[model samples]
Structure formats: C-alpha cells, structure tokens
Target: MLRLDDLTLFTRTAELGSLSAAARELDISPAVASAGLKRLEQQLQVRLILRSTRSLRLTPEGEQFLAHARSALHSLESGRQALAGGKAAISGVLQIAAPSDFGRNVLLPWLDQFQQAHPQLSLRLLLSDHVADLFRQPVDIALRYGEPEDSSLVALPVAAGNRRVVCAAPAYFAHHGQPRQPEELRGHNCLLYMLGGRVHDRWSFVRGGESQALTVSGDRVSDDADVVRRWAVAGQGVVYKSWLDVAADVEAGRLQVALADYRGEATPLNLICAHRDQLSKPVHLLREFLQQRCAELLARVPWA
Candidate 1:
C-alpha cells in the first residue's frame, strides 16, 4: 500500500543520502519529504530510514526496498517519457477556449506561430468571456485569467504576477481632476465590464499594507471589454482592467493611470485541462509554449 509518490521520494532520498537533499532536488519542502517518508514506513510497517541530527541512514529493510523502488520508478518514468515524447508529431484539430480581448489581441497572434511550428496540427480557437465548461464543451484546453472555481479541472500556470490597473483618458482626468486613492473612485464615473451577465464594479486593491475593495459606480457598462476600453480611451470614465490589455494604450498615452499608490490585485493566467491523463502531446507542447510566451508578455509592462 505504499504511495507511488512516497516510493519515488524514498528512491530519491536513498540516492541523495539525506531527506533534505532529496526535497531540494525534487523541488518540494523538507517537511513534505519527511512526511512522505514517514507515510511510506507506516504503510509497510517497516522502518525505512534512521534519522540523525545531521544525516540520514537507511535501515536494512529500507536499503532492500530502495533497489526495487528505483527499478520500478525508472520503468514508470520511461513510460511517462514515452507518452510525452509521442507529442513530437502532433496532427489534429486542437480546440482552445480563451477570453475575448486576450484571445483576439494576444493569443490569436501566438496561435499563428504555433501553427507554423506544427504544420500538421489544425486548430480551433473559441473566444468568449463566458467560462467554457471543459467537461461539456468540445475544447481540449482553455486559457483563463483567474483561478477556476471548479475542482474538476486542473489549472496550470501560464503567467503569474499580472495586476489590474485603474486608468482613464488624459482629457477625462483633466476635466474631473484625478482623485488620489481608491476611495476617490466614488467621485468619478467608473466604467463597468459585464461578465457572466453581471456587472463587475467591485475593484480590489492593496493600500497601506492592507487589502481593500471598492464598489464603483459609472454611467456606462458594456459586456464587451473592448468596448469598455474604447469608451475609456474616448474620455468617458475610469476603467479597471488587466495591465497587459491596457499596456499598449497606456504606453501610447491614450489613457492615464489613476491611484498609482494603490496596488491592484494580481490576476494570474492559467491553461486549464479537464484531466492530466487526457493531455496529449499537442496539449503538452501548447501548454509549455504559452507558459513561456505569456510570462514574456506580462514582464513587458513598466508600472510604478
């Protein structure tokens, strides 16, 4: 009844000669490695390792287990690599769902390169703000802006440290006079973006080492984010949005940033799959490619 992960850890610890060393090599915390080893020992009703103040020595039984476990782990790893390796020749229509603005502005161009790299792979891009049901929809994967609430799907990191910004056109800021903090948003006309049939007017931020949220009011609301961006650029009102989406406009001086002191909440980007076992070689390639590209794009922004 030894856990597969614990067995892998046991072999790693045996090879490294120390639990902490194995943890470092495996990119896991020492406490987790220690607990995994303890779990393995308890399951087998055998003392696998003897721990000292500064070192680790395997019990006689542990040494015997290590030999068999190492061989088994190698076999399992070879099988996994084979599956991953089969991805080199991906030929099929890979369907991916993404948010409307990001999909159009960022992902569409990226997909063009991906198609070039894998000539045999046909692709279908589904763009919408509505969250796709991975289990029900005909989608192989999805790129999303925030953590999914559904426990059934696996969220893989595409990009991290993506923060939103509160901004407006220079003309609007000049007419209204820019208010300083998050609280001042109430005095201005805030642009609202509709998602899932509801208006998202609550803007979250961090001010003075504490988390704060403000429910903003505005004269205009639109389901299409691009429309909201357009309205903001036309000197209509303040808008809260992903910095990356507005990075070009902000840089081009189309919009001016507000509340520079308040830090916007980080909205991580993720590539989600319904099940790891269902992941094919194309999926693996796409996931890795986007992970790299998305990080690069997020890092392109310069903010105060």
Candidate 2:
C-alpha cells in the first residue's frame, strides 16, 4: 500500500522545488525525506522529480501525478472536516502571508487575538511587501489588498470598501502646493513604491465615471512599503496609498488627502487559499473572524 504521508511529502517537495526545504517544513530529516520519495517512486514505477545540484524540477509524470495527489489530499481533508462537523478543534500550524505595513500595524494584533482564542493553534506568519505564492510556499493562506493574480486560488472577500487615496504631508503641501486635479500631480514630487519588480508611479483616479492614470515622478523609491509610508510622513513627497495605511496620519493632521473628489476606486481585500476543500478548520475560523472584525472596520470608513 502506498503511504499517504509519502505522497504528501512528494507534493510539498514538488511545489517548493527543493527536497531539503520541504523536509525542513515537514520536520523530517533530509535523508528520511529522500528515502520516502524514493519509496514512493518505486511503488508508482516512475521517476517523479529531476534533481540537480542547482534546482529541482518535476518530470512529465510528476506534473501529472501532482494534480491527482493534491485532489486526493483535498478529498481526504474534506471527508475529515465533514466527519468533525465543522467544529473541529483548531490545532496545527496555521501559516499565513501578508503585506508589511498592514500586517504589522493592523492585522498583526487581530492575529494575536485569534491565537488567544484558540490556545491549541500555532501560527507562522510571513510578512513581506512582495506577494507570496501560496503553492510555492508552505503558507496555508494569504491576505492581499488587491484582486488575486492567480485564478487557481480561491479569494474570499475580506474588505470591499477599502480604497487608495492620494495624500501628502501638510508640510509638503505648504511647500510644493497641493494639486487640485489629477493632471497637476505630475508637477509635484510623488513617492513611489516598487511591488513585484515594477514601480507604481502611475496613479489612477475615477471622477464622474471617468478614470485616468497620472504618471508621476519622485526623488525616493523603496521596495519596502512601510519605508515608503515613512517617507511620505517625513514630507518627502506626495504618495498614493491605501486609506487604512494613512488613516491615523490623516486624522492626526500629519497628512492631508489631495484631490479627494477624484479618489481611486476601492480595491477589495481578499483572504486567499489554494484549495477551498482542503482549507483547514483554523483557516475557516480565521476567515470568519477577520470578516467580522477587519472587514467591518474598513466598510465603515468614510472614503469620500
């Protein structure tokens, strides 16, 4: 009989593109992991992974096998969840990935509260401005500000009313003068943020059913979003940022919204998971908790 654990190890190794990384994630030794893969291949009578010193790649057979492997795992998980009646005790490592500023400032505290509610549940958080791959990484779920790029994943609506605002520090506006229209932003210095290897210099806004993308320039650019927020706070330049990121600064008189009448369309916040059927009990509970607490907060914000 083929062991399900071996098949799972194979899937993780294939997804991560490394045997050692998958072994480390599964808390098994490298040699043991290698042996398990070998055993699985022997039973299946086919080579699964093409391994080299530099990297690991799945064979044609491996690629086809992976789909069935994941589906089988998902079905098993679904059966278990059904048996437990959706009230299973939330235990096991719940891995999550999220952006930096929002993760640290907002979601981090809520995550803490969730953990407190379920003492048995463990957590592993990967906070980065760069978007994390749910399949490639070991994370069970991700919190993204915009729509998911990958169609393979399932995105749960976390916040629908969250919006991006064009803003600048009061000092910056006093010195450079705030722009009244979207086109005027080209004359002012605009702080830029780089995400996924592209600089977000094109600021978009919709007014009276017309949308425009204003290309702006700046002196400072950073890959880390939190640093960009800091630069905006220091009166370095005007910035196009999420309202949740600048709400405190705006309320405290540190920053002021510019061209509020032409604010950009709201982007939804999504809780993304790889396979809905495979979603763990902790992930389901976490999604519900976030929808109740986090989504409500953003929904109530006065965007105008």
Candidate 3:
C-alpha cells in the first residue's frame, strides 16, 4: 500500500527541488525524506528524481506524478475539512510571508491579537521585500500587494481598495517645500527602494484622465522597504509607498501626503496561497480579519 506521508514528501521535494528543504518543512530528517522518496519510487517502479550533491531535478515520471500527487492531497484535505464540518480548530503553525514594512508595522500587532483570539494557532512569518515563490517556498500563504502575475496561485482580497501614496515627513516638506502637482516631485528628493534588482524611482500618477510619470533621484536607497519608509519618516526624503504602510504615519502627523488629488498606483493587498487546498478555515478567517483591520486603518484617513 502507498503511504500518504511518502506522497507528501515526494511532492514537497519536487516543489522545493531539495530533499533537505522538504524534510525541514515536514519536520523530518533529510535521510528520512530521501528514504521515503526511494520507497515511493521503488513501489512505483520508476525513476522519479535525478539527484545530485548540489542539485535536484524531477524526472519526467516525477513531473507527471507531481500533478496527481497534488490533486490527491487536495482531495484528501477537502474531505477532511468537510468531515470536520468546516469547524476544525485552527491549530498548528501557519507559515506566512509578507513585505518587511507591512509585516513589522501593521501585521505584527494584528497577528498578535489574532493569535490571542486563537490560542491554539501558531504563526511563522517571513518578512522580506522580495517576492516569495509560492510553489518553492515553505510558506503556506503570503500577504502581498498588487495583483499577482502568476495565475496558478489563489489570491483572496485582503484590502482590494489599497493604493500607493506619495508622502514625506513634515520636517522634510518644511525645508524642501511640498509639491502641489505630480510633476513638481521631480524637484524634491525621493527615497528609492529596490526590488528584484530594479530601483523604483519612477513615480507614476493619474488624475482627471491625465497620466504623469517622473524619475526622481535621492541620496538614500535601500532594498528593504521598511528602511525606505523609515527614511521618509525621519525627514530624509519623499517616499512613494503603499497607503496601508504609511497610513498610521500620515494619521499621526509624522508624514504629509503630496499631490493628494492625483491617484498613485494601485496596490491592492491580497492573501495568496500556492493551491486552493491550502485555503483552510483558518486561512479564510485570517483573510476576513485582515480585510476588516485594513479597512478600519484606512478609514482613519481619507486617502482610500
């Protein structure tokens, strides 16, 4: 008989491209994961993966089985949830990923309250500016901004109305003067943030059926989005950031919006999963909680 554990190990190894990584996620030793994969291949009588010291790649047979394996897991999970009346306690550790700034400034306190509400549920959060590979990473879900480019992942709206804003500290504006229009931002110092090796210095906006873009320059730059926001709050330079990220700062009068009439880029927040099967009751509830919290936060300001 085939073991479900073996199937899970095989699928995770294929997705992560590392037996060790999959084992770490599943809370098993690398040797155990390797042995499980070997047992599974032996039972199926096919070469599943071409393994090497420094690399791991799925063979054609493994590639074909991967789809079926994921489907099977999904079906089993669905059955289990259905059997539990969809009221299963949201226990176990949920691994999540989010942007650095939002994770620290916004999500941290919210998650704390959420965990308090569900004492049985634990959270593992990965904070980064770079996008996480939903298929490859160990994270069960990710909180991201903007519409997801990959169609395979399931995206649930957390804050669909969220948008970017151009803002800076009052001290900086007092010294450099605030721009009344989008185009005038060219004369001010703009804090730049880099992601996936590209510097986001080009500020774009739209207002009254007109569109404008400006390539602003600044003395400070950081790959970490949180650092850029901090620089803006410290009066270092103007920043083009997600309103959800800077909403509290703006509300507290630490930062002031520039060119509020012009609408900046849309940055709709979402909770994304690699597979629909991953959307358990906990995930759905988390999405709703996030939506409400985000709505409340944005309501404090008229920027939404």
Candidate 4:
C-alpha cells in the first residue's frame, strides 16, 4: 500500500518542480524528499522523475500519478472540511508572505490586533519585494500587489487601491522645476522600480484622450520601496509610490504630488493561496480577517 505521507511528498515535489524546493516548502531535507519519492516509486514499480544535476522533470508515469494524487488529495481535504463543518477551530502557525513596505506599514499593526483576537494562533511573516513561489516556500498565504500572472494558483482580491501620484519633495521641484507633461519628466530626476531584471524607468500618463510613455533616468535607485520613499522625502529625487506609504508625508507638507494630471490607476492587492481543497481552519480565518481589514481600510481612502 502507498503511504499517504509519501504520496503527499510526491505530489508536492511534482507541483513545485524540484525536490529541494519541495523540501524547503515542507521544512524537510532534500534527502528526505528524495527518499520519499524513491519509496513512492518503488511501491508502484514505476519511474516517476527524470532526475538531473540541475533540473527535475516528471516522467509519463509520474504525470499520470500526479493527476490522481491531486484529485485524491482534494477529495480527502473536502471530506475533512465536511466533517469539521463551518465552525472548525483554528490553532496553528500560519506563514504569510507580503511586500516589505506594505507589510510593515499596513499589515503589521493589524496582525497585532489579529493575534490579540486569537491567542492560540502564531504567525511567520516573510517580507519581500519580489514575488515568492508559494509551492517552493513555506507560506500559507501571500499578499500580492496587482494581478498574479500564474494561472495555477488561486488569487482573491483583498484590497482595492491605486498607485500613488508621481511626487517629489518641494526642494527637488524647486531645483528642477515641475514637469507639466509626461514627456517633460525626462528633464527631471525620476525614480524607477526595477522589474524582471530591467529598470522600469518609463512612466505612463493619459491626458486629453491620449496616452504617453516617458523615459526617465536617475542617479539613485534601490529595490526597497521604503528606501525610495525616504529618498523622495529627503528631497533626493522624485518617486512613484503607493499613497499608503507617502500619505502621511503628503499631509504633513513634507512631499508634494508632481504631475498630478498624469497619475495612473490603482493596483488592487490580492491574497494568493495554493489551489487545494484541504485549507486548514487557520488559513480560512486569516484570509477572512485580512479581507475584512482591507475592506474597512479601503473605505476610508479616496484612491481606494
């Protein structure tokens, strides 16, 4: 008989595309993952993976097994949920991933409140600017900005908000003069976010039923959004950031919105989770909590 634990490991490895990545997600050693897969394949008398030094691929047999394994796992999860009913209690560590600045400013305070409400629950929060692979990381849910490109995972929109106006310190605007059009931004110091190994220095704007893209350059750049916000606040350069991060400064007259006519639309925040039927009670509770908090906050903001 095939072991359920071994089958779970096998399914996770196949979904994640690597034994080491699966091990990381499962909080186990690669050796354990390898042994589990070996045992699983041995019990079935079939080759499952075409292993290589640098890559992993599922064999035909493995592919077939994966479909069945996923379905079975889903069925098992559904049954468990049905047995527990809707009032299942939660008590476990819930791992989460979120952007560094957003997590620090928005979610951290709310998390304190959430913990107070549920003392039995613990949380492990990972803050990063780049998107994390949920199947390769030990995360129960991920808070992502913008829509996810991956079709395999399930994404739920939690917060509706917009990108901030292109803004700078009063000093920087006085030194460089304010830009009237998107094209004029080329003459000013513009900060950019690097995406997908490229410096996204191009700014998009729409006015008078037309759209334009402005190419910009700057002497200072960093991957952290908070660093960019700090530089802009200190009169170092102009930056485009979420209003949530700069709203306080804007209200305090520390920073001013530049080229307000060309501001872009808001990007919605999303809660992402693996597409699985057996979500634990803790995950469900946290997801609902986040959604409720996000909704309440967005209600008070104009851009949201």
Q: Against the unseen true structure, what C-alpha lDDT does each candidate score?
A: 0.82, 0.83, 0.88, 0.76
lDDT of 1 by residue, 58-104 (tens): 88998777656755654564467577676456776687999887888
lDDT of 1 at 211: 96
Using lDDT as the measure, the top candidate is: 3
Flag the better candidate by lDDT, 1 or 3: 3
How does model 4 score by TM-score? 0.73
Candidate 2 — which residues are off by over 4 angstroms? 15-31, 52-57, 86-88, 299-302
Q: RMSD (Cα, Å) of candidate 1?
A: 15.4
The RMSD (Cα, Å) of candidate 4 is 4.6
Pairs of colliding residues, candidate 4: 162-266
Off by over 4 Å in 4: 8-37, 46-82, 86-88, 174-181, 207-210, 248-254, 276-284, 295-304
Please provide, for model 3 over 39-127, each residue's C-alpha lDDT reduced to its tens digit, 9 standing for 90 to 100: 99999999999998999998888877876787677668767766877466767668899999999999999999999988988898999
Tell me how far the alpha carbon of residue 195 in candidate 4 is from the true structure, in angstroms, after superposition: 1.6
TM-score of each: 0.68, 0.86, 0.87, 0.73
Candidate 2 local lDDT, 121-170, one digit each (tens): 89989999888876556677899998888898888887767888888889
The CA root-mean-square deviation of candidate 3, after full C-alpha superposition on the true structure, stands at 2.7
Best by TM-score: 3
Q: List runs of model 3 lying over 4 Å from the truth.
A: 11-33, 52-71, 86-88
